[model samples]
Target chain A: MRLLLVEDTQDLAVVLLKHLRQSGHTVDHAPTLKLAGGLWSSEKDAYDLIILDIELPDGLGTSLLKEVRASDVAVGVLVLTARSQIEDKVYLLDVGADDYLTKPFSLDELDARLRAVKRRHISKPVVTQSVGPLSYDPTNRTVWIGSDQLQLRSQELKLFESLIDSNGWSASKEYLFDRLYGLDQDASANAIEVHVSRLRGKLVDHGLEIEAVRGYGYRLRYRLDE
Target chain B: MNDLWSIRRRLFASWFLMLILVSVVVYWSANVVVERSLREGQDRNLQAVAQVILDSAVKIDTVIEFELPYQAFEVLAYSAPERIYYAVSVDTQHLSGYRDLPRPEASVNAFGALYRGEPTRFYVGSKPIFPGSTERLRVVVGQTETSYQTESTTIAVWIAVAVLVAFTLLALWAEFSLRHALKPVIEIENDLGSRAAGDFTPIIRQVPSEVARLVQTLNRTFDKHRGLLEENRAFIAQATHQIKTPIAAILTRAELLEKEVEERSRDSVKDLIVRARYASKLATQVLLRATITYREIVGVREQFDLTTLVSSVLRTMDPSAEIKEVGLTLLSPEDTPVVLDGDRIAIREAITCLIDNAIEYTPALSDIEIEVYETDNEACVSVMDRGPGFTIDIAQLSGFDTSKKDPSHVGLGLAIIERVAKSHGGRLTISSREGGGSQCVLSFAVS
Candidate 1:
């Protein structure tokens, strides 16, 4: 991941630059808001994320964040500030900060938050996701249970993808139906149950099952042994 | 005791007292005037009747002749229902009427004396028997005062009754006017009574100018108080906010030095970093305490779903918990939404403190459970941890308790939670679970 660090304090900037770089991220540092803006324009499309500091030598970094957001660039913004007041943090978030970390934050926490923000933005082109022994590849449109590839109908594949994307959280039947059929297509509610039943039959004795959450929808449950 | 404080009652009492005094004075004046007028009127009638008798006297051929006026005597009886007496005499002569009637003093035109064994009015007069004759006829008229007394008494009593009735009506009017005049005062009292605590909004209801000055002063005081609170809040926020940057810089420098230092010096560097972090935490807590106090004076309340708040707090704490190998879980009713009114930030901070405290104490891979649900009229957040519970009853520490806190804990977390709970008119309870853990419950009213 590539990130831009906007900070004015020399020692703090040095530590962060070294830490972020050592963590395998390509990082560029700017010591003032003016320089940060220049760097942003120079490499507008280079940075996947920007770590903004609120107190900048030239001006507030929040203003820069707003500018970046206003532009068409698709980069994540994580605000770093010594203003631990809830109102200050909430204001930054309201102004399109993807995440906020108070001053004196641990390096590990900062790294985790950056990764979380990256995950949210980069999940659009998900290549593979696995739940228990079941792995699905969206690019190749393939499904695997353990070492074996499972053949599934088109609607079954759609249902499986929806359930997997829910990440163990139950997905409502309405949500599943919308993903299965396009809005313009006329489909009955019974069609979902049919596809779910067929999928469940295929997974019988395979240590994986679709369990119904009463009054909600279905969730994928995993077991080590059947 | 309450009436002493009541402006309405006091005004009514004062007006009614004054009206009663005036009524009594009016009644006394009416009695005196009626008695005097009736006596004067009776005396005039008696004198006229006596003059008639003297006028009827005639002298013929030097022998005086006297004629009694029966009609004149009869007219005297019409003054009231009383007996009439008349007597005529020449020099020492007695003629025509009751002889035993006492003669009045010579210069007295009318006198009140005992006549016929009852109080009576008498008139005495003299006239010459012939024109310019030295000889004169003396006449006295006496009448029983039964009727005069009755009529005078009746008039006086009626006047007194009228005055009394008028005064009673006047008192009622006075009471009503007092209430009407002080209506604004009563309204102010009622408005103050019904307001929620710390609600110092200006009195917007229209008031009389007399009381409007007082209300204006009260409103100005409230405005000043609100201004002071805002200033205090801003100062505390700014002071704490400014404190953080240097603290952050120090900690950053310390961490950087710790990386470059030898193994023997690393412990001391790490110690310095911990102390710096502790100072930062203290500053944050102090700021939070000041904010809670300020909010107690000027609260910013909004309605939000309690479950959503809890879930978000859990998510924010998850990363830190993961680094410590601790698990944080939320248990709440999925469909039953617990909505409450509060300052969301303060509430979130309080929950975060509770969960963070648990994470700091519990062993690695231990579970910390946060449950949010509604019970009766309250929304409850209970955090249970399977950690070493406190030997002393933490719930017993009411306000600020730093005596029994652990060495690593600053003891501000519980204080912050307690202050936030109190500001919301809520409660905080801590108890050891029966099995082997501690549970802290913070509950707020649903209103």
Candidate 2:
């Protein structure tokens, strides 16, 4: 993925740029809003995501974000700010930001958010995604292990889709339930547990596994050797 | 504070007292004028009868003889129903008519005396029997004064009563006018009474000139308060930005260094990252506390459902809880929405703090249960964690206290929860769960 990072603080910017590069993302760093605007105009269509800092030395990064959005560029914008006030977060999101991260965020979390923002903003229509011997087609809603389609109930398929959307991050049980039953449905509290247990059994043989994060929920990942 | 002596009551009392005084003065003056005139009419009648008798006298060789007029006495009878007496005399010598009638003094023409067991008025007249004659014949007439006295009293009382009724009606009209004049002030009071807290909008309603100054001062005060709150909000936002940016930079740097450093030195680098993260959290919490306190001072309140608020807080805390591998569960009455009236932001922060604390303390793969319930008069959100329960007496913990068991745990979370609960006329309680772990309940009054 290609990203544009607009931040003024040099100490933080250097580490973030290094971490982002190590995570296999191609990044261009700009320490001021003026430089960021220049980069955005020059390579506006080349970037998949823009990591913006709200406070910059020259001017606010929001101005550059607005410019990028106004040009109708299909680039994901993830706002990074030290302002954790709910109003600021809401305002940033309301102003066309795909996602936001408060300062002092974990590198792993930042990478996850970047992927999530890219998925939301820039649509790359892939037919199938694979994990080792397992392959799933999102368009057809089918899973195959060595050319044999895995059988799953409608609820189980929905749970699988929710976990897949998490992008290797854990999806909470409440979130999974909401995805499965929707807002107005009447279902048992343990309905998610039953579906997850059944899905776990089918995925284990395909070099893919569903791991229950005890206090959280479930994450779908490649199976590790025991 | 003297509620009984309101402006209306005071004005009415003063007017009432003045009216009574004027009524008494008017009645007394009217009585005096009426009695004097009536008495004068009686005296004229008496003098007329006396003059006729004096004119009827015939002088025979220096001796005077007079004939009493019957018609003149009858005229006095026609004026009012009262007894009358008359006498004709020369130097105290009785001529005709009642011999026992009281004579006037030698120099006085009219007088009052008791006659026939009743108060009476007497009149006297005298003239010489012939021209320049020194010997004068005197005539005296008397009548009882009961009828004229009664007539004067009746007239004075009726006049006084009429004046009293008219003044009383005037007083009532004045009271009605006063209330109508003050209608705007009452409207202002009602407008203020119905306002929601934190609303500092100035009163712009039209008012009478008499009350305009008061309303203007009130509007100025509202403007001043609105400006101060706005400044406070801006300051909190600025301080959050100024304080946390560098901390984030430091934490990110420490995290990076932890990976590059040798295994033997990795623990120290990890500690550096933890401390930086803690500092960042502390700064955020402190700013949040200030914001909540400011809102409390302004008394911002709204109605919201407890279940919905808890659900949102759980969602917000999900990522952090996920990183810790802690499972979150919500238990609430199905189809029932527990509603409470309070500062929604403050309450949301409080619930977030509790869940955050639970996630921090509970081990990985443990579960945190959040329940929303309502009692008879309170709406409660309780967070239960399958972690080591409180070791010390919960009552000893202050908002800023550092936990003895966990050095890294500052008690700001509990402090925030306590502050929110108290501001809502609610309470925060920490108790051991039935089987294990800890339960923290934050409850607010339903009102």
Which numbered prediction scores highest in TM-score against the true structure? 1
lDDT tens digits by residue: candidate 2, B82-124: 8988878887677777888775566689888887789899988
- Cα lDDT for residue B33, candidate 1: 85
Error of 1 at A108 (Å): 4.1
lDDT of 1 by residue, A1-226 (tens): 7899998878788888888887888999999999999999899999889999998877899889989989898889989987777777768978999888888777767876785566445423345676666677676456766556675545667888888778564689999989987887666557677678767877766777888889999987876744
Please give, for every candidate in the order listed, the TM-score of chain B alone compared with the true chain B. Answer: 0.79, 0.66
lDDT of 2 by residue, A74-178 (tens): 889999988877657657866888778888777756765665565456333346786557667785566666655665545567888888778564699999989
Model 1: per-residue Cα lDDT over B1-447, one tens digit each: 665757666776786787778767766777678778988988888888888777777778866666777777777766577888887778887656787888766577789998768998899988777778787888888888877777777777787788778878887887788778878888998998976666776788778789989999999998998888779878987887688877777887787788789999999998888788788878787777777666666667899988998887876776677555466767786566789999888898889888988998877555688899888888999999988876544456444456744334566778788777877778888888877889999999877
Superposed by TM-score, candidate 1 places the C-alpha of residue B278 at a distance from the truth, in angstroms, of 3.2
RMSD of each: 10.8, 9.3
Quality of candidate 2 docking, DockQ? 0.25
For candidate 2, give the lDDT of residue B143. Answer: 88
lDDT per prediction? 0.79, 0.80
Docking class of 2: acceptable
Name the candidate that leads on lDDT. 2
Off by over 4 Å in 1: A21-24, A124-226, B1-6, B55-108, B111-120, B143-158, B180-184, B194-197, B204-220, B255-271, B293-299, B333-336, B361-363, B387-400, B405-408, B411-425
Error of 2 at B202 (Å): 2.7
Q: Give the TM-score of candidate 2.
A: 0.67
